[model samples]
Target: MNMPPTATDAIKDNLGEAGSHLKQAASAAGEAIKGAGSAAGDELRLGKANLKAELADSALAGIAAAENMGDAAREQMDVLMDKSRDVLDSASELIRERPLTAFGIAFAAGWLIAKVARSSNK
Candidate 1:
C-alpha cells in the first residue's frame, strides 16, 4: 500500500536539508577566515623584516660617513702639524743664525709678560 506523506514529515525533511546546508556554509566561512588571518600574519612578519634590513643598511651608511669624516679630520690635523713643524724649523734656524738677537727678543718678551702680569695683579 502506498502511504501519502503527512505535513509533519515534509516539514521535518525540509528542516534537515536546511540545517545541513547552513553547517556547510559555516564551515566554509570559518576556513576562509583562517586563511585570511594566516596571510595577514605572513605579511606583517615580512614588513618587519624589511624594516629591520633597511635600518641596518642605514646604520652601515652612517658609520661609513662617520669614518670618512674622521679620516678627513685626521688628514687636516696632519697638514697642520706639518705646517707647525716647518714654522718651528724656520724659527730654530733664525735663532741659530742670530743667537744674540734671539736672546734679546726673548728677554724683552719676558720683561713685557712680567710687566703685564704685575699690572693685572694690581
Candidate 2:
C-alpha cells in the first residue's frame, strides 16, 4: 500500500516552487535594466562626441570667412589708394603747366555760379 502526501508537505512544495520563480524573475529584471543603462550611456557619449566635432567645424569655417573678408577689404583699399594717387598726380601736372590760366578759369566759374545761385534764390 502507498501513502499519500500530507497537507503540510504539499504546502511546502508549493512555497519552494514560488520562491524559485520569484528569484528567476528578479534576476531577469536586473539583467534587462543593466543592458538598457549601458545602451543609453553609450548613445549619450556618441552624441556628445558628434556635437563637439560639429562645433569645431563651424568655428573653423567662421574663422576662414573672416580671414577672406579681411583680405578682400585690404585689396579694395589698395586699389582705391592707387586710383587716388593717379588722379592727384594728374591734377598736379595740369596745375604746373597752366598755373595762372587754371586759377583764372576756376575763379571766374566760381563767381558765375555764385551769382546764378543768388539770383535763383530771389
- The Cα local distance difference test for each model comes to 0.98, 0.97
- lDDT of each residue in 1-122, candidate 2, tens digit only: 77899999899999999999999999999999999999999999999999999999999999999989989999999999999999999888988999998799889999999999999999
- Residue pairs clashing in model 1 are none
Q: Candidate 1 overall Cα lDDT vs. reference? A: 0.98
> How far off is residue 100 in model 1, in Å?
28
TM-scores, in order shown?
0.54, 0.54
lDDT of 1 by residue, 1-75 (tens): 988989999999999999999999999999999999999999999999999999999999999999899889999
Where does candidate 2 stray beyond 4 Å? 72-122
lDDT of 2 at 58: 100
